[model samples]
Target: MSSAQWNAGQAHGEAQAKTEEWVKSAQNTANKACDKMADSRESAQHGKEQSAGFIQQGAIDGVKNTLGINEKK
Candidate 1:
């Protein structure tokens, strides 16, 4: 092959390699962001459940207190 043709092929190969590297890097970043979002969602759901439990308990206690059945603690 001529020197010019060989140089062009080399440049093409380098460009392809760089593009692939960029794609992988982008994929990794997106995956990390998605994982963070999922974690936040799970944490929010857990907090909601805890708050609901507290509310239910308060309602139960209110009923007992109104009936003069409050337990000694």
Candidate 2:
């Protein structure tokens, strides 16, 4: 092949390699973002469960106090 043809082929190969690398980098970033979102959702769900438990316990204590079961000796 001529030198000019060889140089053109090399340039095309380099461009393709760069494009593939960029795609992989973007995919990795998207995966990390998705993982973070899932983690945040799980944390929020756990917080909700804990808050509900606290509210339930407080209600029980309030009822007992109203019935004079919590009176001081």
Candidate maximizing lDDT:
1
TM-score versus the correct structure, for each prediction: 0.89, 0.86
Q: Which stretches of candidate 1 lie over 4 Å from their true place?
A: none
- Tens-place lDDT per residue, model 2, 1-73, is 9999999999999999999999999999999999999999999999999999999988988998899896545
Predicted candidate 1 versus true structure: per-residue lDDT over 1-73, tens digit per residue? 9999999999999999999999999999999999999999999999999999999999999999999999956
Measured on C-alpha atoms, candidate 1 has an lDDT of 0.98
Residue-level lDDT for 69 in candidate 2 = 94
lDDT of 2: 0.96
Q: Which numbered prediction scores highest in TM-score against the true structure?
A: 1
Regions of candidate 2 where Cα sits further than 4 Å from its true position: 71-73
Residue 29 of model 2 has an lDDT of 100
Model 1 lDDT-worst window of ten:
64-73
